[model samples]
Target: MKKSLVLAMVLAGFAATSFAAEPAFLADRHVARGASCESCHGVKAPAPGAKVSSTACMNCHGSLDKVAERTKAKVPNPHYNHLIGTDCQECHKGHAQSVNLCGSCHNLDWKVP
Candidate 1:
């Protein structure tokens, strides 16, 4: 009986702690604001007006053109695959908290020195 009571208390405490943990998907401010690209990607959307897909971001930002010019060094085209099905928010996150987005793909440890 005593063991069971202690187990119940421990379970309740664990549940409370788990609920307090913050989820990564919930950290995006753009999603919270409801201004997702779907607003533009939806049916009857205008050209370059409603939908701002990653392809759109790449039309100019892709091929590392901008990054190369800025840093004078070639960078990987990380957004190419992301344009197929995901949004800018998939890896690059910003809202309630800031995170290291590019670091996910461009590992500093693997960078050619």
Candidate 2:
């Protein structure tokens, strides 16, 4: 390929990649509090779309009871819901927007931030 064509292809590749890869949305929240990828994921490099277990989350966030207590004031506590033992990742997306799974079925006015 001509040099100009090769250069154009490289630049196009970079632009495509930039649009495809979103910023790690939740990284700043935990990283600012002295957490790293290894600290949370328990690996130096967690594979793309790899899930961090609830056990890993509880390590720093305490038990389910503790989480429920923290949200005690919120009526129909999310942590103490019918889906009590659900994995933390169900509603908590590390790199994407967090969701209120409870609101999926019910018309609850809760935000999962």
The best candidate by lDDT is 2
Candidate 2 pairs with clashing backbones: none
Candidate 1 lDDT over residue span 1-113, tens digit each: 69999999999999887755534443233345554544434444345324345554455456444533554443444433333344654544333333445566657332211
Which residue segments of model 2 deviate by more than 4 Å? 1-24
Least well predicted 10-residue stretch by lDDT in candidate 1: 22-31
Using TM-score, give the best candidate's number.
2
Positional deviation of residue 35's Cα in model 2 after best superposition, in angstroms: 0.2
The residue ranges of model 1 lying beyond 4 angstroms of the native Cα positions read 23-25, 28-83, 88-113
